[model samples]
Target: MVWPPSLRQLEFGDGFTVRIATLKGPPSLQQLWIGHWCDEHIARVGWPMSLQQVFFSGNFDQPIAGVAWPTSLRVLSFGEKFNQPIAEVMWPASLQQLSFGGSFNWPITGVVWPVSLEELSFGDGFNQPIAGVVWPASLRQLSFGNRFNSPIARVMWPVYLQELSFGDAFNQSIAEVVWPASLRQLSLGRWYDQPISGSIFGVVWPASLRQLSFWCRFDQAVAEVVWPASLRHLSFGVCFNQPITTVAWPASLQQLSFGDRFHQPIAE
Candidate 1:
């Protein structure tokens, strides 16, 4: 089918294999989401110069070499099955956000990140130690997936980081982790089953933190967990059956959300 030249977004869903080589013209496509059958022919097509976001979830087991990607691309995402190490891929310099899926288990310790990157996300299979990785200085947000069990306490977090997230399997205590002072939002893994104990209280939270969120399976006594005075928003996910009566809520807390399992009543 012939697409119009003014097309801005294109999504190739399941059961459809797009052969870009057969396409007639370069539509002004800004976003491209491809299915599993998309092959190397994508690089051979005359992509629109206005293209900015590309999401490829194909069966790319081998390295994606010599693909002439659009220089205007800003966001790139790979599906769970794309396991090729990205160390050899010539990433576009204009990229600001990058994400990997569960199939990506490659180590990127020595890989150089784009200087323009602002956000980075890892999939469930990514267990590499990011402590020694040279993160781009411009990075402000980072996230980890369920299978990522790396010890973040030893990693040197970026000074400019404002948001951080952990996966369910990240069971390490943050007692020794030096959080960045610029952090404002923190999200704990939904699958983290450990109780919130002294390991959490031992760490000194950054004064800039304003939002703190806990995920499912985080059942612990709130009395033992020290609430940071700088916090303004607090949230708990389902399966968190902890009581709040014995806990000391910080005066700065402006909002509070409880899960269905928490049956304790709040005092006025």
Candidate 2:
């Protein structure tokens, strides 16, 4: 039920928990309270006051549109209905995991990820990926668009990136990617690219990389592709038009799956 007053602070037991029954205008308290109510449920929540995770979702009109601010918050996600100018919002410095899955008309231009940010996800709507967004030093997992040709070649990934997943747009040339030595798990595949280049740079495969999947359509032969020695789990799809002749299996590779025809197999 909607709160009768626009500014009413519902105090819960101690801190770490709160339920705004009906906030009329703004919180009269100085600690943590709503300051303004401009066509917004709570344009911004989680001031320096007390609150761990804040979730704001409504059809209010504001710059933030729908956002929550928790100084110590580790995860921050914008609702799919959020279409306002989110670029104006300053992400919390304590954020570790962030997901932008909203189908908004705006693109996340030049926003630096906080040093605390570790995992980041971008929905399909993020058009024209940023050429260079510094990944957080602590970042490990990154999942973004996978269909068509999403420009990931230029984005400056964190040196510590480990688990990376592409949605469907996997048409990137391996040559364009500068894999970090700290990388562990790399997953790339899908109906995304019609013709992928097999000659893409062959990563020596970091010793950290344990789980890896190479699936997708390639105009060339699979034999041209080189598998990293550290890869443990590998999955290959009908990405290669021609058959693969030699399949170099890494000693660490324990699980392998070859879907459909891959030209020639490990030379029998």
Candidate 3:
């Protein structure tokens, strides 16, 4: 079947098998989606060379050890049912953003990550240890999945990381973590209610931090905590009913949001 020469995006909802040496995908295709029960060996050869974004969704749990990832691919997403081991997979060098779906929960200590990756996120099933993992230098935004509660106190976070988010299960101590100087955004998980001021040496606040979020169950007191000088946005989730009257609001704060349960009055 002949496809339109100008076709730039394509999606195959049914099972698709890329025949060896006879792939007939769109020449200028920039986006491709392979959905539901796709043949795991679809990578027998290679995808369209011009592909910039690719998505694989539903039941693709096969090993991708020697798959030839598109060299020009910039963004790749794996959907909910994917849960494959990727320790031996070669990631595309051109990839900048990647996201894993709900079922992915592999230990990535031995995985070779792409050097140019800027954004990476995991889904709900991830809960692996990551203390000694060396993150990519080019990573700017990173987030853990819902089940990730790994101790990251000793993890060497990327020096240039600007944004970091944790999953709902994260409740680790941060007494020894030295926040990266380049960090701009941070999000604490739903169950994170760590006492920052109670730590022997209070958690070091990154001077460049701009945005901070506390998820559903956070109700920690911030009265004695030192606020960052550059913080502009701060938010508390649904369960925050803490008294903020004695808390020192950052001078640089531009927006502040409180949860529905917050009954504390702010002094002008």
Candidate 4:
């Protein structure tokens, strides 16, 4: 398919070539989906006519160097062998969702989340550090994997965060995580390391939290399973033989699960 220099919409799949010169005159396109075999070249997407979604997949023979564009992008999803500089990637102010799960790297600088972003998900193989990112104010969900190699310190969660998940290999301390008031579901799973220190759990949790699960090493027993009064689902975990006494469960609890120590089913 021949691409007009001032093209406003372009979608190519298989046996197609997208040369940098194909996109000339700085045409502002609203949608672009490239799933073809193209020559390796760096090109700017120039101005987008309110770009809403973009998808780049499959193996582009040569390293597609410096392919950055889409200043008005709202949703960006990348897949397959994408060895490009992520730092050069720019997101539009109207961006609301971002899902990236491939292999790419750029200089260790920082990421600027869009003002309107609501959801962010990182698939397996992402090892970038989101430590100093200024989170989006309207974000509701942030999901990531253990590939984030840097230690997370302080985070300014959106006042509306409701669901958060960190993959098993993640080793950062949750001591500094300040849950937002609107948070309802929080999960900290499969992490390498024994019993998280008491001081770690000392951080105040969202009073509105309904579901809580700790699947990592709890080398010691928690004297109290402080399940939020609004909590309906609770999961308590202890090391294989770590002893624990009768937990003070909330009457509001509808379902509960305990590990090996409490071999019996949780009472209603």
Each prediction's number of clashing residue pairs: 0, 22, 0, 2
TM-score of candidate 4 against the unseen true structure: 0.72
Specify the highest-TM-score model's number: 3
Writing each residue's lDDT as its tens digit, candidate 3 over 1-268 gives: 6779899998877566553235577779899888676646555755889989988877666667878988998999988888888888899999999999999988889988999999999999999988777789999999998888988888888999999999889999887887789999999998997777755847788999999998888887787889899999999998888777788889999999998899877773
lDDT of each: 0.78, 0.57, 0.85, 0.62
Scored against the true structure, residue 51 in model 1 reaches a CA lDDT of 85
Compute the lDDT for candidate 4. Answer: 0.62
TM-score per candidate, in order?
Answer: 0.82, 0.71, 0.92, 0.72
lDDT of 2 by residue, 103-139 (tens): 5446556555678888887666555555566567899
Which candidate has the highest lDDT of all? Answer: 3
lDDT of 4 by residue, 1-268 (tens): 4446566666777666657434533245667776646544545444355556766656543333354545566777666555555444456677888776545444324566678889987765666666566677889998776565455546667788898877666666655567788887776646533333355554455788888776655334444435467777867555433334565666787887666655542343
Worst 10 residues of 3 by lDDT: 14-23
Candidate 1 deviant stretches above 4 angstroms: 1-4, 18-27, 41-47, 193-201, 221-225, 237-246, 260-268
TM-score of 2: 0.71
Provide the global lDDT of candidate 2 against the true structure: 0.57
Judge candidate 1 at residue 150 and give its lDDT.
Answer: 74
